[model samples]
Target: MVAFAVEHRPEFSALRARLDEARRRATVAQRSLIPAPTLYFGARGERAVIDPREVRPNAAGQVESLGSDHRSILLAADVSLALPVFDRAQAARARADVDALTVQENLSIEARRVRAEVGAARASVAATRSSYERWRAIGGAVEEATVLARRGYESGQVGIIDSVIILERIARGRIAQNRSRAEYWRARTALGRAVGVIQ
Candidate 1:
């Protein structure tokens, strides 16, 4: 039951998720200490005027170069890497580690709480069941007395006052029995809740 509560409780699930996220953050921070290479790629176009001496007159009397247009495209690629001269991620890693530890402790505390709750609920159920059974027995005895009182009164062997008193006692006994039964059911419900079986 303790294990079931820990595994199925929403609070525990949330804590577990938080712990996982904290651990992931810690790992990322630790890895960040290792520098990674960054690659860059670029392209550019450039235009340059041809020298007057290189220009020639075309057949249509227009100035044109002997080759194609004086435009050029340049492509460049480079990779940059850091040497990790300083441990810049140390503080972040430490913070993440602390957060993970805190969450782990919280989860442990919550599990302990659930265990205690389950134990208390079980005790309550046992106590209430015992009380209910005892009350039921008392109620049965009271019912028998009521029946005898009624018979005596009908046969004129018992007075009205005594018969009235027995009837009242039976009523009170039934009330007590009903109350005990309700308490027993309530305790069972609480036990179910503590075990995470009652949502």
Candidate 2:
């Protein structure tokens, strides 16, 4: 019954969503041990015109082709990686992963327990309700029988002792009816608690 409630209950989806979020977060945390790579890229271009006497020369005694009247462009790209040198980060990540797993497992266990409780509560409610119904059905019959016994005693057809017994039976029937009603409500309260609707 609790299993059914977990699946069909309106509030269950939100609760399950929280668990899913926790699972995703734990998975991401577990992968944090591996360092990510870096990428870089850049480009530059320019069109330039220089005076006839603005040329530059190099130690080779020739114009170093410094683009005296040139269109020039430069492009560069690189990727960098950092090696895992220290064990501390790996150890911490591993510990965090273990903790996250533990949290999830504990939640699973508690959920199973709640499901079981829900099943038990449902059964209890049904049993108590059946008892209550039986008591209610017999209550009217007991009252009618008590009335007949009283009339019979007044007419000398039944003894005073029989009337007293009949009254006692009526009282017991009322008590039983009340007890069954209380039990039914108590079972419903238990069910509500198991479903987390009540504190």
Count the clashes in each prediction. Answer: 0, 0
Best by TM-score: 1
lDDT of 2 by residue, 146-165 (tens): 78888898899988887798
Poorly placed runs, candidate 2 (over 4 Å): 1-92, 154-156
TM per candidate comes to 0.65, 0.57
**Top lDDT: which candidate number?**
1
Tens-place lDDT per residue, model 1, 6-76, is: 98888999999999999999999978846654445555556675767778998899988765556555544
RMSD of 2: 8.9
lDDT of 1: 0.85
Each prediction's whole-model lDDT (CA):
0.85, 0.73
Find the 10 residues in a row with the least total lDDT in model 2: 79-88
